[model samples]
Target: MHVVATAGHVDHGKSTLVRALTGMEPDRWDEEHRRGLTIDLGFAWTELPSAGTLAFVDVPGHHRFVPNMLAGVGPVPAVLFVVAADEGWMPQSAEHLDAAHALGVWHGLLAITRSDLADPAPAAAEALAEINETTLGDVAAIPVSAPTGSGLDDLVTALDDLAGRLPQPDVDAPVRLWVDRSFTIRGSGTVVTGTLPAGRLRVGDELEIPSLGRTAGVRALQCLGRPVTEAGAVARVAVNLRGVPADALHRGDAVLTPQRFRTSDVLDARLDRTGDDPLPQHLMLHIGSAAVTARVRPLGSDTVRLTLSGALPLRVGDRGLLREPGRHRVLGGTTVLDVAPPALTRRGAAAERARILSTLDGEPDEHSELRRRGIVRKDELKRMGVPVTSRPVAAGWVVDEKLWAELRSRLPDVVARWRQANPLETGPPVDVVRQQLDLPERSLVHALVSPPLAIRAGRVVRDDTAQVDHLPAPVAKAVDELRARLAAEPLVAPDATQLAELGLGRRELAAADRAGVLVRIGDGVVLLPESIDEAVRTLRTLSGPFTVSDARQAWGTTRRVAIPLLQYLDRHEITERLPDDRRQLR
Candidate 1:
C-alpha cells in the first residue's frame, strides 16, 4: 500500500482533487463542507493501475492549520503537491513545500488544479520551477481540473508512477504509531488512527505510550475501514487498544513497541539550516505527528542541542523540523545524532561533544557501535534494535572484540603479578582483577581469567600456582607434635598458654588451619580436624539429650576444652543446643 499526503495552498482544490480521484468525499467534519475548507485531516484511498493501492491523507492547506497539516504529512512518505492554476503559487504553497523539504520528503507529484479556469501550461511551468529549487527537484507535474474532470486520468497515472518508484517500507523496524486521531468506541473501547510508514501492527500485540509510561494491548486492527488481523507499513491503520482510556490519550500521543525506543527531552543533532542566519534560541520542533517548543543550543557550525519542552520517543538517525514559533517559517532540519545525550557541565564540553558526534555521523556498524559505547549489555542492544552480528564475549555482555582480545592477552601477566605481590592471599579479589584490567563488568574479568586462570574462593587464581604441601619447617614440626598429642586425647584442645609453648601463635595457627592440619575451636584454642568428628561419634552413644557435664564426662575432657568443643559442634550443626544448656545429636 502507498500512503501519500496532500500539500499546497488553502482552497487550492486539494480536497476536491482527492474526492475526484477516490470518488469519495475527503472532508469528514460538517464545518469543513459548510465553510468550504478542510479543518481537520481527511482520509481517502483508491486503486491505481501501477501502484496496486494508494491512500491519501488530505491535509488542511491553511497557514493557521500548519500543525495539523504537519501531522498528516510527517509520517507519509510521498506528497501530492496541489497548486491552483489561477492561483499559481500562494504563501501556504511555499510553506508546505518548506515543510516537505524540512521533513526530508523526497518523493511527490505536483498537481496544477483548477486548470480549466486558466492556462494549465503557465501554472504547471511555474510550480515546476519552484519545486526544482527544493529537495523535491523537478518531479512530474500534471494539470488537472477536479470539477470539470479534465486531465484527471493523467494525474492518476503520474501518482501511480510516483508510488511505483517509492522505496519499500522496512517491515522489520520497530513500531511507533503517532496517533492523529483518538476516540473511544461505545462498546469496542479506544481506537487510534495513524499512518504507519514502517513496521507491522497485529492484534493482541502489546504497545506502550512512553510519555505516559503506560502499556496497552492491541484489541483489534483495521486498514482502509476494513477489519484486519494485521497490517504492514505504508498504510493507514486504526488500532483498538485494550485497557487504555480515551481521555488518557491525545492527538500527538504515540503508541509504540515498549523498550525499543528511548524517550528524551534533550537531543544532540546535526542541523541543516535553510540559511546561514543564526537560529533563534526558541523554536518549534515537529517530529512525526507531534510538535513541541524547544530551546536550541548551538554546538558547532552545523551541530545543535535541542532541549524539548516534553519528551519525544526518538532514536538516532530520526529527522525533525525546527520552525520559528508563530512565524510559519521553517528554520532548519535536524538529524538526531544522540538520544539520551550526555550532560555538558564544563567549558569546552560542547566542543568535545561535537567531536564525539562527528564520529557518529552515519549509521553505526557493530564494531563501531561497541567501540562508541565501550560496553553494552546484550539485552540492551536488543531493546535498542541494534543488530549484534558478532558473538558476545560473555553472557549478557557485549564488548568490542578487539578491546576484549587486548584485555584477555594481559590477564595472565596481571594475575601472576598480583599473586607475586600478595602471596599470602588465596588469589586476587574479583574486584581487584576488574580494576587491574580496567573492565566495567565483573563478568568480563571472569570470562578472560577462566581456562588459563580459575576463580578460587571468590578470587581469581592461576591453575598452576604451587599448592602448599607443607608449612615452614618450624611450623610443620609444631603442627606434627600437636597432631600427635591430639591423637592420644581426641577430645582435648590446647589452650592459649599451651599453644604458645608449642610455638603455635595466632599467625602459625591460622596457617595450620588453612593447611587443614588443625581446627581452631575458639580464641587461642586448636584441635585436630578429627576431634570434632570423634566428639560427635561419642555423644551418639548417650540415650537422651546430653548436658555439657555429660558430654565432658563422655569425652573425658575438662570444661575448658569441652565447653568450646561443644560450642563448635553446635556451630557446625553436628549437635543442637537446648535452652537448658543441654546438647543432642542433630
Candidate 2:
C-alpha cells in the first residue's frame, strides 16, 4: 500500500502541488480558503501509471501546528517532502522532517516547487541535500511549478518509482484508522476521514468508534472525488459513520476492529530529550496523534517506565516515540514493554526500573515478547499490525521450551520436598504446588502437574494418606487373621469391634475402605467374599422366598443382625423387596 504525505514549510506550495497533481482543491476549509493557508490535514488521491491511484496527505507545515503535522503523518508510510525553489529549507520544513523521521517514514520523493520564480538548481540542490541528511534523504528529488506545470512529469515519475518500492501494507491485518479529521458532510451525517492502516472498509462495515465506546456503521465511502465501494490500506477514506454523532468523533480518536486491541496501564519505553533540555522525571507522551501525561521513570540508563493515568490498549511490540510536555519535537521511538504493570511506589522505584531495563534488553522478537509478556490473544497482535509469525520476543525472558523442561524436572523435586516438609501429612494441594512454581499461564499448571505427586479420584489429592502402598505390617496381619476366622465360619463375618480387636485403627480402616480393600455390605457387620457366598447358599437351601423373621431364626441370628443383612442385600439388588415384607431373588 502506498500513502504519500506532503511535508515542508507552510505556503512552501504543498497544497498547490496537491491541487496540480489531483486537479482538485484539497483546501476545503472556508477559513483556509480565506486565509490562504493549509491549517489542518488535507487529503486527496490520484492514479499513477501501473502503481494505481495513491492517496496524498497534505500536512500543515506551520511551526506552531506540528500537532496537525503529526495527525497527517501518523498513518502514512511514505511522504512527499516539499520545498519551494524561491524559499528553500525553511524552519517548518525541518520540523516536519523530524516528525516524519521519528515516525519511521520511508519511500518518499522530494518536490521542489515555484521553479518559475527562481533558478531552481541551487535551492533544489541544497534542499535535496538537507532532506538526504535526515530519514527522507535517500528519496528521489523532483523540482516542479504548480502554475506552469514544469517538472510535473518528472514529479509523477518519481512518485511512481517510490510507490513501486514501498512495502505493501497487509490488507489481511487488523483494521485501524487514525482519524485526522471529522465533520458533517451535507446529507452524509457525520463524516470522518483518515488513512486506513490495513484491511478493507465497505459501505456497511461496522467500525468501533473507540473514543465513544460505541460502534458506527460505514454509510458511504469517497476518495479523490470518486465514489468507491471499498477502500483498502493506505487510502484516504471519508466514512459517513452511522449512529455516531459529530460531537462524539474528533481528531486522534481511533476507529478499529472490535475487541481486537486491549488497553494498557503501564508502558516500558525508550525516550530521549528532543533538545539539550534536561530530562525530567515526568513528561507528556504523544503517539498516533494522541497525547497524554505520563510519569517517566528511567530504567538503568536507556529505558523508561511510563505510568499513565488511564488505560490505553497497546500491543506488545508497537513502536511509539516520546514527546515531552509543550514540545513539538520527538524524544525517541521505542517498542512497547509490559502493557500491564503493578502500581509501584517510590520505595520500590529501583526495582521497577531494573525490571523495565531487563525487559527492554531482549531482542525485539515476537516469540520472546509474548513469552515474556505471558500470553497474547490472536486479536491483540492483529490490531497492532504485527504478524503472528514475526511477533517480537520480549528480551531477557525465558522461552517456553526451556521453561517447560525446567518445570517438568522440578516437579519430582517439589514432590520430594513436600513429603519431607509434611512428614505427618499426606501431600500438598495442586494449587499450592502451582503457586510455588509461579507458572506463567494458568493452563501450564494443568500441563505440569502429573502422576505420583497428584492423583485424581473424584477430585485431585496430594496427601500421602491418599497414596496406594502395601498395607502397614499391623493392618496386613489384621486382614490375614480376619480372613482365617471367616473361613472357619463361612456363614458369618467379623464385626467392626472384632476387626478392631485384630489391631487396625479406625483411620486405617477408613483408608482401606477408600482404597476398596475392605467391603462393607451391612451395618454393624464386616464381610469377606467367602462369608457372603456361604450366607447366600444357606438362604437358597432354606426357601425360594422367606420372611425376615423366618430367615433370622433359620440363620440362628437376632432380628437386629438379620434385618440389616436383608436390607443390605435389598440395597445391592441381590434380593428384591416383595409384597407383605417377604424377600426373594433367583
User: If scored against the real structure, what TM-score would every candidate get?
Assistant: 0.84, 0.77
lDDT string for model 1 (122-181, tens) is 878888888888778879888988888999999888998999999999998889999999
- Looking at model 1, residue 245 earns an lDDT score of 72
Best by TM-score: 1
Weakest ten-residue segment in model 2 by summed lDDT: 390-399
Q: Please provide, for model 2 over 1-586, each residue's C-alpha lDDT reduced to its tens digit, 9 standing for 90 to 100.
A: 4688898858728999999998877786898878888888787778898788878888887766777777778777888888888888887776777776666666688888998998878877887777776666676678899999999988998888888888877787567777777889767789877888677888888878666778888888986556888888867788888877657777877787777766665877655334555566666555665656777777656667888765565665555556653655566655575555445568977676576556563234556555654545444544543446632223222335555577778876775677466432334456666677785444455556666445443222344442333345566567667767766764465666777787755665654444444546655465565455666777887757899887787777666567777887888787888887898975
Off by over 4 Å in 1: 409-424, 432-440, 467-494, 498-586
Provide C-alpha RMSD values for all models, in order. Answer: 4.3, 6.3
